[model samples]
Target chain A: MSDALPPGATLGILGGGQLGRMLAMAAARLGLKTCVFEPAGDCPASHVANHHFRAAFDDAEALTRFADACDVVTFEFENIPTAALDAIERRVPIRPGREALRISQDRLTEKNWLRDLGLAVAPFAPVDDAESLRAALDRIGAPAILKTRRFGYDGKGQARIATPDDAGAALAAMAGAPAILEGHVSFAREISVIGARGLDGAVACFDPGENLHEGGILRTTTLPAALPHARATDAVLIAGRILTALDYVGVLGVELFVTDTGLVVNEIAPRVHNSGHWTQDGATIDQFEQHVRAVAGWPLGDGRRHSDMVMENLIGDDIARLPEIARDPAAAIHLYGKAEARPGRKMGHVNRRTGPAA
Target chain B: MSDALPPGATLGILGGGQLGRMLAMAAARLGLKTCVFEPAGDCPASHVANHHFRAAFDDAEALTRFADACDVVTFEFENIPTAALDAIERRVPIRPGREALRISQDRLTEKNWLRDLGLAVAPFAPVDDAESLRAALDRIGAPAILKTRRFGYDGKGQARIATPDDAGAALAAMAGAPAILEGHVSFAREISVIGARGLDGAVACFDPGENLHEGGILRTTTLPAALPHARATDAVLIAGRILTALDYVGVLGVELFVTDTGLVVNEIAPRVHNSGHWTQDGATIDQFEQHVRAVAGWPLGDGRRHSDMVMENLIGDDIARLPEIARDPAAAIHLYGKAEARPGRKMGHVNRRTGPAA
Candidate 1:
């Protein structure tokens, strides 16, 4: 590991979404400054920070200035160009590193990494063209998902080939992008383990949360996941193994499927996840703070939730219910500084404190 | 008393100190925009806000622009000029309005207001010059403090006159400014009631915190003060009375002396006080958020502390001890983004959480 970053040092963030906004707040609490880089004019992180470079990822001058200003850099989203990271890494250290990025950016590489780490993932095959699509379908069989190998998120750029006739529509819909076909895993519930790994190989995991999705967007996350104790232990161990192998230095979100037989890895997020929002009210240190502490080389705080928590995402029209939500004694609301409530956009979230037993 | 600032509107803050920084963070959580106006470069509030105006308070053009950009204006420091508020008030309402400033800016006026409000304050008389100082001493007696009527803070611009021979020296020390001579209160403890008052006549108060001062600077504040339950209740009621009588629209901090007879009003801070820093981690809703909610015309939150707390200020060299403090499970540290650490300058603070019973 490189030299530790002292307090009052600057942290460079690659994306300026709500995740970066929360991350900046956490960094400030630890006496660290944040310089957020984003392309949007009124990104959420800009409101809470003064040092912002509003330039595209390819702007070398801006990138150089950002690298020069920060002691270490981290990204809020996984879609950051590897070339931009390469240019900055020459000047400053980037935590969670580029190795994790390369594997997580593409679905096929991520799946392979999971399997290589001795983790159970869905059966999958790569598809580059019509011939490969047909061959992969023959191997994975029907009722498989055809998804772009790169840049697919929140259920976008994916289609289901349920029958022989649907293959043409699925292939045409995905266009010319390199893709992957995966047989669906029979699961009873969706759960995610949000945990952090330090440079010294210390792993701290938060309680797993049960998640619900609506129209391909996360709607709510409730703590005390439905998984059995042994299954939860296995889920955390799998996540820890992946982080350790990648030599990750920040929080990693592991999405899992709780099947009747066993737990299977669904996907991996190399940064703080939306499902971890409950930690802000329920735990001693939230996921953002934990990520900051891990990256800053501070000892990770206990991620135990003191009380049960229910976190609900305020998406588009759901923001209209803020007045009612504000009146609830058990609820704590957080709204991002987005101007318009567009469909599928994350506008805000409300976390409600529940009974400990629940 | 003025047009209600709705949830989506912006709140303007005059000073960019830690109190304003906390206020801006609080406003962000409520879906309200915060615009901080301060002359200094890289002011504390500027780092955690959506908009910041780097202009002097008396700059008419800049003040007009700032006033037009905000729905309501509040100040973090009481020494702001009346003319500045008059300009902003012509455009938007100023919360904890001009009356508070009028009282707080002049020691004589503040003393008279406390007496007028049917509250107990130190016996005092005005002194414009050496002749007047002698006259004031005859009425108030010796062994009292001679303080300037305006622009004094943290024991500065004041002198303790122990004898008739020291009256002339104290008067000369004040540089012929308007002043007040007051008999000091002998109290068992020093405590402050930090609370917020909504425009709709709602009031929320946190438990009183006993304060300790060193070298004329506040060093520590311990919550769940040793005062009797009846006295704590009286303190909250008195703070509510002052907030209502002044038509206060935001958080008001009332510092009191817990004497053997009863609680006496020492002074009123029209904005958040340093002694309330513990609320950042201990209280469910901090004083900063409470002020933002009151100014935004939103309902007040439960300002109860989840645990007992002791907040210690990190003055100058004290900041170097943060690494040891961070290792403690109960410590919540906050650092202001200040470049220099001059003697007696506040650099940051640490809040240590203890169980409520402590």
Candidate 2:
């Protein structure tokens, strides 16, 4: 609590995507100014941030200048360059810390870390070359997914091996990058928990949301996932355990597979997740504000859900339906202000309240 | 509507206060960019807006530049200079229009207009010199108030006429400015309705909230004001009538005194009102977004209440209690990012949800 930044202090954000934009707005709501560091001009975050430092992450001089301007630093994405983090860490503290980023940055590392923590995770093995790919396939079996060990998101950098004959093409899909083979797990549904940890080590988790994906991209998330009371409590407890383990001081998104036996960890996001977007409309305090509060060393706000909500993403050309969506009284629209609507690009989202929370 | 500004269009704001700041954030939520024109640097709105034009209202060149960047223009305050509005009107339309501002800028003009529209208002008379002041006092009786016709807010530009003998001092307090004397009306409480009208002439009004003022500044606004169902309906209807008469295309605040016989119109504001701040946390659609929707020619959102909320303003030294307030799980804090907490300055506000709406 003694390290708590005052209201007018500056919070530096690493990425200038839609996540950063929403984070900047949330920081502004708490009377904090934000400076965004991104290489591109007119990035979504720059539109709302107090300051924008447009430079490549590898530029040490620009990183120092950006770090010098902020009282505390946080990031919107986990893939920020290690050199940039190293430069900023020398000047100001980064919440969720380097360890959380270190683990979440690579698939192999994240899987090993979760498994070592006694958490149930999908069977996985690392693949650095063709020979290793064959070994991993033999261990994990066919019907596996080969993914780039790093820098993969939104169903990108992934190839499926339907049978033994498909292993060669799946291995070639790696394109000389380090990869990981993950065995498919039979699950009833997918769910995610948005969890937060304060500077004082207090943990809070929002209720799990059931997620639906299309073409390897998230399409919708509905709150109060169909789970028994005990299982719901277990999901929240699992999220809290992870936050406490990392000594995390910001919001984290943990995606889970609700199997017939138990919940299995599919992946974990070090920053705010698209699945948690419903909190903006259904809960008392949203995940963006929760992250800002944690990084700023403020107390964790109440994350109780007040309404049942369904959050649907408006990807790419789906934005053409804005006129009709705008007419829906139940929908709360949020757009990223992107100029082009390329296929699969996340244009915005709409949170529609179904009713009061059960 | 054909005039509807598409997403990514810039909205020009006249004032850079907290209301402007909130408006800029709301516009950003709807995928609209904002450019704020204010004389002061580092104003609240400037922190969130996409652009900040730092120039006085009378600076025609700066006003023109600001207007050139915007598809539509709106204002956060009513006292914007006529020349500035004239310059902007040539390039783009200003929502709520100039007629609303013309009547609201002067007390005498507003009272006359309301009365002519068959609405009940306090007995008022125009006063210029000593002779007129005396005549107004003789007609309106003692225990009245004399206020300057323009540029008055938060109880400034006013003097109490406690008795007939106090008339000379009250007149002198006007500083030779045109004035209006308003007769006192005994009332149980004060309530306000926030209403909006779309470009298509559709009107929507939020639930009225009872207000409490101290030192002539608003302190708190609580939803579900103590009023009969019919009286509340009447209050909302009165506000809709005012908006329809003016052909207003944004939010308007109508203050009413709950008297023994009926509700009396105390004043009308042609912009988002402080009392409506509760809607940010209590309703499905807040006043700021509603105003943005109206001005942008988008469909007006439903203004239905979702939770019971009490919005308390943190004025001046009241900001010192932030630590305690931040610890309250029920409080949703909104700070204006002001560097100094000067006396009587509005630093921020907190909306506390007591429970779900009844």
CAPRI band for model 1: acceptable
Candidate 2 chain A lDDT trough over 10 residues, lowest sum: A1-10
Model 2 reproduces what portion of true contacts? 0.72
lDDT comparing candidate 1 with the true structure? 0.85
- Poorest 10 consecutive residues by lDDT, candidate 2 chain B: B1-10
lDDT of 2: 0.93
Instruction: Give the clashing residue pairs of candidate 2, or none.
Output: none
True C-alpha contacts between chains kept, each model in order: 0.46, 0.72
Per-residue lDDT of model 2, residues A81-175, tens digit only: 99999999999999889999999999999999999989999999999988888898888898999999999999999998899788889888889
Per-residue alpha-carbon lDDT of candidate 1 for residues B225-301, written as tens digits (9 for 90 to 100): 88889999999999988988888878888999999999888888889899988887666677887788787777777
Model 1: runs farther than 4 Å from truth?
A: A129-143, A161-168, A226-231, A355-358, B1-8, B131-142, B162-169, B356-358
For every candidate structure, what is the RMSD over all alpha carbons to the true structure, in angstroms? 2.8, 1.0
Write candidate 2's Cα lDDT for B31-51 as tens digits. Answer: 999999999999999999999
